[model samples]
Target: MREWLKQLREEKGLTQESVAAGSFINRAYYSQIENGVRNPSYEVAAKIAETFDINPARFFAGKISEPFTLALKNAPIVVAHCDLELKYTWFHHPHGVFTPEEVIGKTDEELGIYKGIPELIGMKKLIIEKGMPMKKFIVFQQHAGEKTYVVFGEPLMDESGEIVGAATVSMDVTEE
Candidate 1:
């Protein structure tokens, strides 16, 4: 991803200092990002993409296939996988109420949280039962608070092509 970003900047005849200054980010930070010494935050990526007149999603093309943990280290999102029973199996919490250990074997219902999102419930059901993938925007409401998220969910298939679970990559969109 760093290489791609650098290549794009070079192709655009843009310099690190100029791009960073224009994008309202520090030149040193941008330099580090280009040099592969540090990963850019999602916000920084968006700003840089905007400066280059590219959609941020398009700018990040091919980046999502990178290791989720490495790619999402500074992203305001959570990536999680759940069994067909809706029991949480694993999660990467960039920002979330639940921790890795907290929800490993429990459902949100069991934790008394984030259960008010009808859209998410339906999407998970579809993934588990019909092996469908979903890209959805949802507002999750728990008794404590509410947060908007853009969620992507896909069925996890077993060796025999049977759906065994669901994987979700959700970004917090409340600030946006």
Candidate 2:
């Protein structure tokens, strides 16, 4: 399925019917495109993009390279995506004792995993607000032990080039 398309639609607070109406396409056809059951023609893609006010190129930019995916999975790093509200939307390879379920849809402060570390939260906010990339070394002290991570974050932009969120990759640097 086009997960990114779904995310964009949800972010815009649009329904399939609304999008179809706006794009001059059938709702079922739009549903098929969204569910990956059917591929849209370039014309159709352009129409949908126009409806969303995004570039048609976004439709073709959905897939990540398998090699990059493999590299991230094999590396000792945690990757996450957070919306402008600072709530986690996607998390992978969590470190420490936290699980994905505990992190998703929650803020760092809400999870209490990075409590007393306002810098980490502030960094995410800065990236989103300033639309810039940032990197820092953060140390977390838990009951289990102390762990250090080199965290890198960049702003996520939407079709009109507005910052909508932040994406982060944090590699364990304690052993390094």
Candidate 3:
């Protein structure tokens, strides 16, 4: 998986530093992950996915099925996926207020949607550092109203157990 991921990174013409910027992770951290000296959390996976323009599931292809919940696409829960570069791969927004066009090609720094949330970036860093899954409770304040969401992130590893990417799901918990 390291080779595959390294190949992907090379193919994309991105440097480890470029990928980790604003990703809440240091370049040395990612380098260790790639070298198999460290494990990566889901957040790291998401950042990498964004950097490489690949699906998070591709990193865990053999370990897990595609992580998408087809039924959740238009459901109340809005799921999203990103890579190490903080790019959004998939976003399921039932209300359509958040479209893929608004996310798919952009980085976290580029997207203002999560600009003010300190924990959003923190969570991503924690995942990369721990090489494990993590959860966070998030509430968004918008002109329409306020909504609460529970986010779950899991690291995607390659066949040899190297961290490659991450997949995330956001389930709306608004009572109203």
Question: What are the per-residue Cα lDDT tens digits for candidate 2 across 11-111?
Answer: 78999999999999999999999998998888999999888765565465334334555666567788888888887766677244676546655688877
Give the candidates in order of lDDT, highest first: 2, 1, 3
Which scores higher on lDDT, 1 or 2? 2
Which digits, one per residue and each the tens of the lDDT, describe model 3 over residues 1-176?
36556655665687878777735689998888677677677778777766665765444532352345444545777666666665665555657465554666455566665422456656666676688999988776655677777878877666898765566777778788
Best by TM-score: 2
TM-score of each: 0.56, 0.58, 0.55
**Off by more than 4 A, model 1:** 1-70, 142-145
Give me the runs in candidate 3 sitting further than 4 Å from their true place: 1-70, 113-116
TM-score of 3: 0.55
lDDT of residue 136 for candidate 2: 92
Clash totals for all candidate models: 0, 0, 17
